[model samples]
Target: MYLGLDLGTSGLKAVLIDDDQQLLGEAMSALTVQRPHSGWSEQNPADWLVAAEEVMAALGVAHDLGAVQGIGLSGQMHGATLLDAAGDVLRPCMLWNDTRSHAEAAAMDADPKWRAISGNIVFPGFTAPKVEWVREHEPEIWSRIDKVLLPKDYLRYWLTGEAVSEMSDAAGTSWLDTGERDWSDALLAASGLSHEAMPRLVEGSHVSGHLRDDLAKRWGLKKGVIIAGGAGDNAAAAVGMGVVTPGQAFLSLGTSGVLFAASGAYQPDAPSAVHTFCHALPDTWHQMGVILACTDALNWYAQLVHSDAVTLTQGLGPLQAPSETLFLPYLGGERTPYNDAAARGAFLGLGHATNSSAGARAVLEGVSYAFADCHDALSSTGTQIGSLVAVGGGSKSAYWLELLATVLDMPIHVPEAGDFGGAFGAARLAQMAVTGGGASLATPPRTERTIAPRTDLQAAFAEGHARYKRSYHALKEAL
Candidate 1:
């Protein structure tokens, strides 16, 4: 048996799998994000631990955890979790969606060395700028910092009593030499950090450490069960779906929207705001165009109309022409093509005729348009994405999938319904860690069906997308 633990923004999920690679059992514990002020998002590290322990305990009640041979972890990337010399958390982790460090990010991004070495734009949510934010605003906390770990690595520290990070997670820190797959001294120095503040680096498929004896006994696991150096959430999802090679891609419509394409080599297009980060596997890289809001925008609109997302999406009869209404879906700023942290969402073309359904459809189309922007940005990098497998909570809506396919003019495959997410992918990594297998074990799940682009509406969507693009530039200042 093997175990996979995923620390997500909203919850922690634990999955158990037998040696044959079939899921035996799974459990989850709920979590909540704390936004104490505008433009900031945080989670208490203690909450993550509590949620993790709860899920593990629930799984233990039904499964034979003692037989587990390996463990793997996956989590949201770019969260800055500071630690003191005694290994105590200094504060709530600053999450990936937090944009309070925009000034620090902009100042660091102005230095060409950051892009030249890190192959990224040094966005406000990246770990380096968040650390810099603390330095400027909370110097006392900054001075006592002995190490900075990503969200998953902090969980790993508690599990194994060691601080280690893998490539996929570290690449987002703006302190990694992505091409060389190592920490960049120049970038670290520029961020007011050094190698000592960073954790030991490892490949995601390799064993980083063993579970601590006390925890192993408490959780009914065997002694010295290995822990794999797992991936950031997106990379882990790619691993789970077997999209590990060049030309393979996946579109994620979670709180944020992402278009991820695996690459055989390092290809940086920092100016385009396309993220070039390490893949979970060694000697591989990937490019991503991210939008800060997707389902988040839908949920916001749902609340505004006093209706749930499912009800709003279900009420729509059929896919119609693009609504006169246009939404910017930039509720919490944006990332790809325009790294504007002050950007906000807006609905253009609203009139007396506009109703709740039209607004909901506009929200969906706006997110699709944001993805179209992502597709174009990735295209500018000469990345060839033949098709994209759709994943995440928003993909549950057939209407949204069809609309997204039509907007992108690409086929979107939906895998047979199951838990092919970060936790499952982490389990695959655990299998690799124990068995010494690689991509062969990470096969793509069976495709239940494919959503092909609607050729009839291509021209209309093309025009709508053009207008959507124009609206951003015209109203960015006002919005």
Candidate 2:
């Protein structure tokens, strides 16, 4: 048996699988994000540990964890978790969605070396800027920092008592030489850091360390079970969905929206705000266009109307033409194409005729248009996405998927229902770590059905999308 632990923004999940890669059992524990100040998002590292232990205990209650031979971890990328030499957390981790470091990010982005070396824009949520933010605002905490680890690496340290990170996660830190797949001394120096303050690097599929004896005994696992260097969430999702080959793509509609495509080469289009990061596997890379909000916007509106996303989306009828009402799903700024941390969300074209349903539909369309922008950004990089497999909480809504299909003018595949997410992908990595297998083991799941673009609504959506694009530029100054 093998174990995969995914420490997500909202929860920590544990999945158990056998040598054949079939999931035997799984458990999850919830976590919460604390936004003490505007534009900032954080979580206690202790909370992550608590959630991890909760899931493991729950899984142990029902499964034979003693047979577990390997463990893998996956988590949200770009979170800055600081540690002292004694291995104590210095403060709450600054998460990927936090935009508190916009000024720092802008300053770093101005330095061409950052883009040249990292192959990414210095977005506020990236780890480097977050570290810089602490340096400028919380110098006392910064002074004692001995190491900076991404979210998952912190969890890995708890499990194995080691500070380790992999290519996929490190690529987001703006301190990595993406093409070379190693830390860049100049970039680290620019951030007032060095190699000594960073975790040791490894490939996602390789074994990084072994589980600690005390924890292993408590969790009913072998003391020295190998732990794989797992991936960032999206890269892990790609592994779970078998999107390792060049041109294979997946669209994620979680808290954020992402259009991710695997690439065989290190193609950087930093100016376009398309993220070029190493894939979970060695000698591979992926490019992604990101929008800061997706289901988050939906949930925002749901809260306004005192309804849930499922009910709100379910209340709507058949997919209709683009609503006269429009929304910009920039609830927490944006990433791809614009990289505007100060940009705010707005609901345009609202009139007396606009009701709750129309507002909800507008929210959905706005998100679709945001994705259309992402698609265009990727297209500009000459990255062709033949089709996209839909994943995340928002993908559960058929109406939203149909509308997204119409807006993108491309087919969207929905995989058979199961836990083909970060945790499952991490399990696959664990399997690879133990068995010495590679891409061949990462097979795509069976497609349950496909949602094809509505040819009938093609021209209408084109016009709607054009208007949507125009609204952003026209309202940029005011919004």
Candidate 3:
């Protein structure tokens, strides 16, 4: 048996997979995200460690822990976890959702070398800016920084006494040479930091370290269980969906939404809203579109407009024909296609006659419209995506999936076992590590279902999408 874990923003999930890729046991522990100030999101790194321990205990009771010979880890990307000289956490991890470094991000985005190396425009969510935020704001903590690690790499340090990160996760830090697969010396020098302050980079299939003997004993596992270098959550999800091939893409909607596609070469979109990162698969790359709000927009609308509604699932049944209302899903600043940090959400063309259901449906359409914008941007860059695979919490809603298909005018395939996506991808990597095979073991299992586009709704959606784009452009000047 092997263990695969995803250290997500809201929870820690551990899955036990046998050699045949069959799941034996699964466990998850919920966590809280703290917001001490506006546009700031933080989490305690120690909380993730505790969650891992709790889940491991649960897995120990369910399955024979001694049989678990390997471990793999996937995590929320771009979070900053700083450590002190003796390896103590310096402060709460500033998370990917945190937006406190907009000014620094702007400066970094303007630097020609940053663009030349990382192949990305800067954002507050990326690690380098967050590190600068700490240096400028909390000088005392910044002065004590001995090592800076991504969220998952920090967890691995606690588990295995080794500090390392894989290329896929490292690429999001805005301090990596995506093309050459190494630390960007130019970026490091500009940021007033050294490459020695970062963890060593390793391939996703390489053994990052062995489990610490004491911790391994505590969990009733073998002392030398090897931990495979894992990936960022989205990359792992891409691998889990079989997006390792260049032409395949996946659409995921959890708290945020992502559109990811694999590529053989580093292909970046001009104007640079989409991120080009090294893929978990060796010698490959992937591009992703990140929107800060997706399904969460629907949940927020459901709560505010329809508080009396019993369950969110009840809102999914067939309703009246689509309404004239349009929504802009910029509740938490969009990423892909629109890198506006100050942008706010809006409900256009609303009338007193509009019902709660209309508002709810508008939120769904708004997210789908964002997905459409991503597709358009990729197409403009000469990417030929044949299908978009849908997964994550939002994919379970038929109404949401149908809206995405209509808005994009393309089929959406739902891959099998998507709920365990990150974990499954991690397990697959560990499988390759144990067997020493690369791409031959990276393909995901078959998809479960496909939602074809409705030709009848295409024209209507095209008009809505055009209007949505126009609204965004008009609102940009005022924002």
TM value for model 1: 0.98
The number of clashing residue pairs in model 3 is 0
- Report lDDT per candidate: 0.92, 0.92, 0.84
Per-residue alpha-carbon lDDT of candidate 1 for residues 1-479, written as tens digits (9 for 90 to 100): 88889899888988888876678999999889899988999999999999988998999899878899999999999999999999999999999999999999999999999999999999999999999999999999999999999999999999999999999999999999999999999888877888999999999999999999999999888899999999999898898888899899999888788999999999999999999999998899999999988898999899999999999999987789999999999888899989999888899999999999999999999999999998999999999997689999999999999999999999999999787788988988988988886425447888999998889998999999999989999997554
Quote model 2's TM-score: 0.98
lDDT of 3 by residue, 194-294 (tens): 88898999888878889999998899998799898989999887766667887888888887899888888987663758889998867989988788888
Candidate 2, residue 58: how far the Cα is off, in Å = 1.1
- Stretches > 4 Å off in candidate 2: none
Q: For candidate 3, what is the TM-score?
A: 0.96
Predict model 2's lDDT versus the native.
0.92
- Candidate 3 positional error at 364, Å: 0.6
Superior candidate under lDDT, 1 versus 3: 1
